[model samples]
Target: MFKNIAKDEMNLQDKPMSRFVNFNEWIFEIKTIRAIRVSDYGQPYSAMANINIHGESAFVDSLMTKSEQEFARIDAKVISEFLRQLGIEQVQFERFKNNQPRLHSVSLASEPHKEHKAKLVSVG
Candidate 1:
């Protein structure tokens, strides 16, 4: 049932996909499944929603350095909302044997944040 639902939601094509560069601490390659067309030029552009953060150490350090619980709560809320806007239902943090942080698979769902309507954008 879930497989059918997922298949219905996504459109697969054999054509080559466009890649976008995210220049930050780390390099990210974002690919979009749909093509966006401009009304003025009628040119079609693919969307790539990739983001690159410098590294996990920087993120962990920021979280650890927060002195107040309120600050930490605010930070977590921001991150959660950001992820929710990206169609992520839940986020889990994991660490490897070397203590390197990694993100696990994200389960896609409808937007959970109700306060911000401006952040919602149609990707498909």
Candidate 2:
């Protein structure tokens, strides 16, 4: 739920890097959001990817953990929601979710997910 803001209103450091990917006929915007979490002490950030489909958005794969080995995971259900929002039929969505290679086979518990790792960031 972000409104278009003038470039001057955006903080250089606080601004996220956005990328657009075309899926079918819809364009999905993916952006990385960095933030600090206040826990018992201040907790460092976990990389967050915000996905927006036709203005409907969801925050998927935001994981905060002490273990560096623990990776952020994207569940099919989350992706399915986006597809559903795009007016994908139930059968097609199910087929895409089920038949898609490497979708269900990858296990987070066994090994680290082999995807692009987010750049390490620090907030002063």
Candidate 3:
């Protein structure tokens, strides 16, 4: 037998169904239902990803500049994978039609024109 409480009588916060903020993971599929163009009022727009993850609606935006666009795209995919590894059940990304900072997480060695530069490294 299952017992159900009335909506008004239920105090969810006082008694949480699942208290897992430091931890929560979901193994589900993602589908993109809507494809909306996110752009500024006058200037060109960036990018947007509106999809459903495991039945949960999610939106993702990649704030990138002209030069960092290619890199941002690649990084966005990696970020999604990273979130999955971090036990993220759902993710939502918002697109703001405003001024955004440049992406410079990945950097290369700044050496002289004589020596060979090393590989690319991630920087916070």
**What TM-score would every model get versus the actual structure?**
0.27, 0.19, 0.25
How well does candidate 2 match the true structure in TM-score terms? 0.19
The residue-level lDDT of candidate 3 at 3 comes to 35
The regions of model 2 sitting more than 4 angstroms off are 1-42, 55-67, 74-124
Per-residue lDDT for 1-124 in model 1, tens only?
A: 0222221233333232223333554444332222122234555422212233221111212223222222233333334334444334544433333577655433334432332221222232
Q: After best superposition, candidate 1 residue 121: deviation in angstroms?
A: 12
Which pairs clash (backbone N, Cα, C closer than 3 Å) in model 3? Answer: 59-93, 60-93
lDDT of 3: 0.34
lDDT over C-alpha atoms for residue 96 of model 2: 27
Better of 1 and 3 by TM-score: 1
Pick the winner on TM-score between candidates 1 and 2. 1
Which candidate number maximizes lDDT?
Answer: 3
Error of 2 at 17 (Å): 26
Between 2 and 3, whose TM-score is larger?
3
Ranking of predictions according to lDDT: 3, 1, 2
Error of 1 at 111 (Å): 6.7
Best by TM-score: 1
**What CA RMSD would candidate 1 show?**
15.9
